[model samples]
Structures are given as C-alpha cells and as structure tokens.
Target: MSTPDPDPDCPSTPTTTGTETYLSGGCHCGANTYQLTLPAQPSPPFPLVDFDHCTSCRRTSGALLQAWIILPQSWAVFHISSTFDQSHTVYASSVVTAGALRKELGGGEPKSLVHYASSPGVSRAFCARCGTHLVYSRVYEEREAGDGPEGEGDGEDFVGVSLASLDKDSLERAPRPLQHTWWGDGVPWLKEMIAKGCEEGGIGAMEKLEGYQ
Candidate 1:
C-alpha cells in the first residue's frame, strides 16, 4: 500500500481542540524522538498490552505476551531522518509470510516498524535504543479482499508503540482503550488484571515495571 503523502497542508504544530491532545517522547538517548496526537480525556497510562500468543513478541520482550497500542501514523512525527542512523535493526522471522502475502495478495512490504524473529516472516518491531516494544506485523495465509492484500489486512498500517517507554507526561496525554491480543499466548499473571476488569492501555502495570527497570 502507498503511504499517505506527508500532508503538505499538515500543520507544523498539531492541533488541540480539547477533543484531541498531542504528546511527545523519545528514546533514552533522545535519538528516536516522536510526537503523537490522541484523545486526551481518558489517557492511556500503560502503553503495554498483551499480545497473548504471538511467538515473536514473546522472544522480543522476553515475556509470554506482547503488549502494544495502535496509533494513527499521522500522530507519529519523528525528528530523526533514518532508522539506521538511529540504530534500528530488522528481524526476518516472518518475512516469508510477509513476502507471500505481498506476492499473492499484493500487500506491500511492512514499513519503518521494528522487527524481531520468532520464525521466518514472524517478526516484531521495537525502539532499538531503549527497547520500547513497538508494532507486530506478520503475513497470515488468508487473503480475502478488503481483509488481507486487497483491504487494509487487519489494519497493518496502524502502528503500535510501547506506552511504558514513552515520556511520562506524554503517556498521560493521549489515552487509548487497552486492546488484548493473541490471548492464546498470554501469560498467567495477566489474568489478574482481567479479573479486575482493568482497562487495556492504562499505565498501571508500566509504573510497576519502572521500579524494577
């Protein structure tokens, strides 16, 4: 899929109408700087959500489940020019699955997201500098129009970034609904949160992790 052109009309400064708010953050070294605009009311405290059974996420985070959030690519405005200079690395665990989908269904290769290999074509991306887990993109076999190659293919273009790793104030700005993923691979401890009906993207878990990190 073609990337939307940087809106020439896109404002240099993001707009805030009280409905939407903007947040800024970067890696520990400040190399991978970025800004995102999201709804401000119920801010997402924890950026990490469970990718329950995703193998790649397990390997990358060294945890049973991978947690992430989907943000509009437009919300992500980066200062660095290239991911390479910023110390980006790519994993090819699931490239074959991605490649196959592109060939048969015509979905383009994954974009600037990070990659981690659980197996071929089954990689996940995270911030190289600070280890902030990002999005999980893979190639699945099903190819129904508008779902796979033809349509957005489960919203592949939607980029997921780790909320735990972002700057604190920024995390408080653009709150989002927590989303559960790959439940089959989820760890047992997460069930406690589910029992309490914890919201998906809330920062409760992230704060606890910060004490250890």
Candidate 2:
C-alpha cells in the first residue's frame, strides 16, 4: 500500500496533570544545553521516549537506531548554554504557528545552529559546535484547505529531540516505550540490536510487532 498523505495538523491532546517536573540536558561538549518540562505521569497517546528506525533517522544519526523524546512545544522548555555566550543563531521555519512561540523552542541557538532539512517540510536541529542531535520537528503549515487545526497534532506538536540528551532525572522518570514505527523498510543489524536490548535489559518486550526483535 502507498503511504498515506501526512496531515500537517496532527491532533494533540495537552493534558498536563499539574505534576510536571523539569529535566535538564545538553550535548557532550556542554555547548548545547536545554531543559524539558515533563508531566510526572505521561498522558495517553505519547510515551517518554520512542525509538525510530526510519531510514532518515538512521542515516542522519549514522546508526541503525535513533530515539525521540516526545513533548508538546508548550511543555518542552528551551534553554541557553553559558558556553555559547551571545552567538546562538536561530533556525526558524516558515511555519507561522511557531513564529510567535519561538521563545519556547528547545535551547537558545545563540551561536547559530546546524539545521538539516531532512525532508520537504521536516527539519532536524542540532548543535553546530558539539554536533549534538537536538530536535526532530515538522512544520504545521496552515493551509486554506484544513478545518482549523484539528488533525493529529492539533497545531501544537511536540518537538522531537534525542532522548539521550535528556538528563538522568528525566531518564529515570521516563516510562518505557511500548511501540515503535517504520518497519516496512526492514534491516538486519537493528533486529540483532533489538534482541540484544531485550537480553541486556534495555527497552524490550515490544513484541507486538514481529521481526523487530
């Protein structure tokens, strides 16, 4: 079957339980740093961290596997690392929804960011200096044909970032992922890694999808 058309305005249900906590994280060089405000208990339709095996994610990160921490833009907090000083460059998109709320973007790219336009409308931001994978995001371009942003994202989609960038405090608090995607393009080594994760006490037990483990 052909892939379905992507709904730019994917529905999003923001139900912060009022027990949210803050988690801090940065890159290996400390040049890229940010914070994530996560709910104490994860709401439905989203988990703390999810693994992606799509060819894009794998190729961009130079590995067979990559993971993303899903959090709404309203809930995901950005910060500035002292090391960047005053040279952080902003990588903004044509998406008008995020224009006014650019302040809420993850981390202050004061010193300029290395932005990779992974696809036509999808963008992946990373640290220009330390080369840290930051956010995997898509623009919800408001088109005249849509019905007031009622799709899966609801106009305020979560900024996808590397789960490894989240602080340990957040990691401990993160719930185990229950599902994954993009298996139509199967791989060999990743399956081995998944089986190893099951044996070595990683994110496993997600056998609902065959051939992943």
**Cα-based lDDT for every prediction:** 0.45, 0.55
lDDT of 2: 0.55
Q: What is the Å distance of residue 25 in model 2 from its true position? A: 1.1
Report residue 57 deviation for candidate 2 (angstroms): 0.6
Residue-pair clashes per candidate: 26, 20
Please write out the lDDT profile of model 2 over residues 1-213, one tens digit for every residue.
222221122211222346966555655544445556566775545444667778998888876777777666665544333234323332322222222233333445344245677876567777666677777766667323352122345555556768776655666655555556566553765666666776653347444566656
Q: Which stretches in model 1 have alpha-carbon errors above 4 Å?
A: 1-15, 39-53, 81-123, 137-156, 192-213
Per-residue lDDT of 9 in model 2: 29
Alpha-carbon deviation at 67 in model 2, angstroms: 0.9
Best by lDDT: 2
Residue lDDT tens for model 1, 136-171: 444444323443112234433334555554566555
Q: What is the C-alpha RMSD of each candidate to the true structure, in Å?
A: 10.4, 11.8
How accurate locally is residue 40 in candidate 1, as Cα lDDT from 0 to 100? 57
Error of 1 at 122 (Å): 6.2
Worst 10 residues of 1 by lDDT: 92-101
